[model samples]
Target: MKYTVSIEIAMPREEVIQLLADPAHLPKWLRGLVLHEPLSGVHGQVGTKSRVVMQMGKQKIEGTETITRREPADLREIPKGSVVHFDREIVVEGMWSVVRDRLTEAGPDRTLWVSESEYRFSGLLMRLVGLLMPGSFRKQSQQHMQDFKAFAEHGKDVREGKG
Candidate 1:
């Protein structure tokens, strides 16, 4: 299954990209994200892999994220913001996920945050979930985007229920 979600963040595009590019601040916007640790490669560089752990209610989920691509491949260029893409494999549940994050400057202090997610489920149960309850997945993703917008724009700690 594949879905896309977008939001408008009232912050500079560069600032939003900076906040998202850091692993330490993940929990502030990634909802139930409990752990994010690099497992290989040069940190944020492409081909790097990381372990991601998340908790939703009583479910403990684990995934491996392999950085597939990044924008601004060169340092010296017309400076703006980032339009990065990454692919991840959910090891625990046999899901393939890719998310492309695009940030565009809307104004001097506003940004348009657009994210597209593509998911493939391997297991029968997961496929059932994808086919029968697609809205659930979209809603969850939208919530994450909204939470990130609030966190990035207003400094509202979404993980703390302030957003």
Candidate 2:
């Protein structure tokens, strides 16, 4: 499955990108994310890998993510000025997922953050979830974006929305 979601943040594009790129800020906007440990390569660089653990209710979900692409916003001549891009491939259980993030400057003090996600499932259970609960994936992605918007705008945690 593939879909795109976006949110507008009341912050400068560079500030939004910097806040999003920093690993230390993951827990602030990733909801259940409790751990993000770099395992190999340079952190945030392409080819770098990391283990991520998230606590969802009583379940502990774990996954490994490989950074596939990282592009600065200012250096490109895209229609939108200063639109950064980041791509990561993540595998969890029987699921393989790729998420691409684009951060574009909407104005002098506003940013537009977009996320595109693709997910494939191997196990019967996972495939069923994909088929039946596709909205779950999109909801989670949008939640993270919303949380980030709140965090970037007013320094709030994921649980503390509308910051």
| Top candidate by TM-score | 2
Tens-place lDDT digits, model 2, residues 1-163: 9999999998877677778778888888889987899999866888899998989889998999999988853333445575578999999998999999888888889888889999999989989999999999999999888787778877887655535
Q: Highest lDDT: give the candidate number.
A: 2
- Model 2 C-alpha lDDT versus the unseen true structure: 0.85
Q: Write down the TM-score of every candidate.
A: 0.87, 0.90
- Indicate the TM-score of model 2: 0.90
lDDT of 1 by residue, 7-89 (tens): 88888776777787777778888888988888998656677888989897899888888877766643234275545443444
Candidate 1 clash pair list: none
Model 2 residue 41 CA deviation in Å: 1.9
Whole-model alpha-carbon lDDT for candidate 1? 0.75
User: For each predicted model, how many residue pairs clash, with residues at least 3 apart or on different chains?
Assistant: 0, 0
